[model samples]
Target: MEPRLDLLSTRAGGDLFTMLVSANNALAASPLPRATQELVKIRASQINGCGFCVDMHTKEAAHAGESPVRLNLIAAWREATVFTGAERAALELVEQGTRLADAAGGVTDEAWADAAEHYDEEQLAALVCQIALINAFNRLSVIVKRPAGSYRPGRYA
Candidate 1:
């Protein structure tokens, strides 16, 4: 599949992609665990059908020492036993957050309370931001039909 546009060369007033990457980097430095961050991105990308993001994040996660079994089971996280309670909560939030129309009244209070139980206010804030950011990137990639599997780990860094 051919990408409709080259996101790298296209400028949106002021190098929009760069600014987006900068924002992503800020999240990277947040108190949120790196593994959790990658898991959130991967889950959101999977739901959004953003192959580019899936490829990017999965590779990054592996590079950072995430287990292959866990990565492979991310889509089936509900039934997977590899994730911790906190990770499960984040994944739950990602699914609800990304599939808002499918979720009844959006993320459930039960899910929110579960996530809040595992994550502190700051971590919750970061998790929310991470979910929103990945969704935005996923939409862009899906809309543009961005080709997948060519991303190198740390390419944006």
Candidate 2:
């Protein structure tokens, strides 16, 4: 399938896309663990039903050495025992943040507090950015009806 538009070819779209990619690259350089970053991206994509992003992040995470078991279990993270407490907290935040419209209070204070217990201020900032960025990507892909399962690791990087 084809994207409705080539986001990278149009001048305005390309500029905005490039800026977003640059922001993502900077976030990748943050102190947040690579595993955590991948997990958050995959989880948010799943929640948002952005198949292109799900395909992209899952492949990228695997290339970064994320295990199949953990990758497969991200959608059911609440019931999985493979994640650390910190990872769990982050997942909680991802769920709440991604489903903001479903919840009355946006991200709950409880979820934020839980994440704070596991991450420093810098790491939390990185996590927030990661969540927001993934959501934006998800919306763009879903709205454009981008097809999935053809992404290669590092293709965008």
Candidate 3:
């Protein structure tokens, strides 16, 4: 399918995306586990219905040797047995953070506490930022109807 807007072709879009990608790359320095980071992004993208991001992150996760079982089960993570407790906490944060309007008062204290239990302040900061960033990217992609299935792992890198 043709995109409604070629976000990379226009100078404004290009400039915006460059900054966005840079911000995304900077998160690589965070102490948060790479697997958790990728999982968070994938889950947030899925919640936001951003297929482009889902394709990109799932492939990137696989490229980094993430288990296919974990990748496939993210949507049903609550029922999956492949994730660690910490990973489950992060996934809960992603869902609550991504679907803020679904619940009143945004992310609940319970979810935040759950995440806090697994992550120190530094890692929690990264997780929150990751959630925000992925949601922003998701909105942009969904708004432009970004086509999926063509992304190469690290294409943004």
Candidate 4:
């Protein structure tokens, strides 16, 4: 399959993609754990059905030493035994935040409180930004019908 738009080929699209990449780099410099950040990205990608992102993040996570078991279980994280409390909280936030149109109140207080229990303000900020960023990427990829299974770890880094 081919992408409907080559975002990197056109000047406007390339500029937009560059800005997103820059924002992602800034988020990467935040205090959130790398493993957790990958997991959050994967979960949001799954929710968004962005196969390109799911494939990208899973490979990136594995290259970063994330266990196959944990990566595979991320979609089932609510019942999986492979995550920490903070990771679970962040996952919940991912679900809530990604499915914003499905819920009346958006991210619930309970979920925010749970995330706060496990993360500092700085980490929470990172988590929120990462979730939003991944979702944006997902939407872009999905809208363009970006095909999956061609990504290599660090290709975009």
In candidate 2, which residue ranges exceed 4 Å CA deviation? none
lDDT (tens digit, per residue) of candidate 3 on 1-157: 7789999899999999999899888887888999999999999998888999999999999999999999999999999999999999999999999998999899999999999999999999999999999999999999999999999987888
lDDT of 1 by residue, 1-157 (tens): 9988877776682387777788999999999999999999999999999999999999999999999999999999999999999999999999999999996699999999999999999999999999999999999899889999899998987
Report the CA-based lDDT of candidate 4 relative to the real structure: 0.94
Extract clashing residue pairs from model 4.
Answer: none
Candidate 4: Cα lDDT at 120 = 99
* Per-residue lDDT of candidate 4, residues 1-157 (tens digit): 8889987888987898899899988988899999989999999999999999999999999999999999989999988999999899999999999999998989999999999999999999999999999999999899989899999999888
Q: Candidate 2 deviates by what RMSD?
A: 0.8
Each candidate structure's TM-score, on Cα atoms with residue i matched to residue i, is 0.97, 0.97, 0.98, 0.98
The lDDT for every candidate, in the order shown, is 0.94, 0.94, 0.93, 0.94
Residue 22 accuracy (lDDT) in model 3? 91
The list of candidate 4 runs beyond 4 A from truth reads none
Question: How many residue pairs in model 3 have overlapping backbones?
Answer: 0
Question: What lDDT, from 0 to 1, does candidate 3 have?
Answer: 0.93
Q: What is the lDDT of candidate 1?
A: 0.94
**Candidates ranked by TM-score, best first?**
4, 3, 2, 1
